[model samples]
Target: MTAGAIAAEPLGVACPMDLGWRYASGAAMERFLAGLRERRIEALRCDGCGRRYLPPRPLCGDCRLPLDRWVPVAAAGTLEAWSVYRLPILDGRTGEPRPTPYGIGLVRLDGADTTINHLLAETDPGRLRIGLRVRAVWREELRGALDDILHFEVAR
Candidate 1:
């Protein structure tokens, strides 16, 4: 059979899949998450560019240098960019649809050079702005995860 005939044939196979899996948060991220459990924020600082990464990474994106310096970051940050979503979206953590009319933003936390995208507590477009100050709203029970911060609210 010619290659064209083979390509036209249906390629179907029966197989079972296991959707469950485990993810290993590396040393940098592990340390970052540990800080969250303690209600503290930390970032990895790159010596070359002097840029601090919120979700501490092994290497700097710009300098490509191994990041080993740890620095404290404020829970409060500036809303650099934002959008208000009117439709319900699936929450990855809970696997449920989040209530409609929610806000999300790229926040540049104090002491960090990069921005971290997170859910915003404010849904009002008129109230949201680029330079608006926001602070993390932590869950009553602290968990060593990004979701430990329920959301960020406008810092009054």
Candidate 2:
């Protein structure tokens, strides 16, 4: 090395990391899922529009008012919309890649005006329809997560 020569600097630092979040799901959602832990469901009612929402929100968009009124909703709801996932997605709870060929749907449970999006047990497109009646299937052990209801099955 030459006595007066300057040393070359390393370009950049390589620090790969796994990112995560720590949060409170909030009061409204906390109460709503707590209901799920007991196989119960509730929705926030819009006083003006009279719309009941599953997975209750703090305010009603249509009514533009605070939603504090709680209303009981049925476990069974009509299949408003659905789709079969051909790709694998990571499961939020397990932090694992969920298997492909799964089903997801939007359900407007009885007594609720808004639809709740969730998993459907029937993956076969032929067996699922827009107006199909489906019921929630609860897990044997309830953990208060939305997936506590494993999936909706075609109601008998």
The candidate maximizing lDDT is 1
The models' CA-based lDDT, in order, is 0.91, 0.89
lDDT assessment of candidate 2:
0.89
TM-score of each: 0.85, 0.84
Point out where model 1 deviates above 4 Å: 1-18, 92-95
* Model 2 poorest 10 in a row by lDDT: 1-10
Candidate 1 local lDDT, residue 135: 94
Best-matching candidate per TM-score: 1
Per-residue lDDT over 17-58 for candidate 1, one digit per residue giving the tens place of the 0 to 100 score: 436669999998999998999999999999999999888889
- TM-score result, candidate 2: 0.84
Instruction: Return the lDDT, model 2, position 45.
Output: 92
Clashing residue pairs, backbone N/CA/C < 3 A, model 2: none
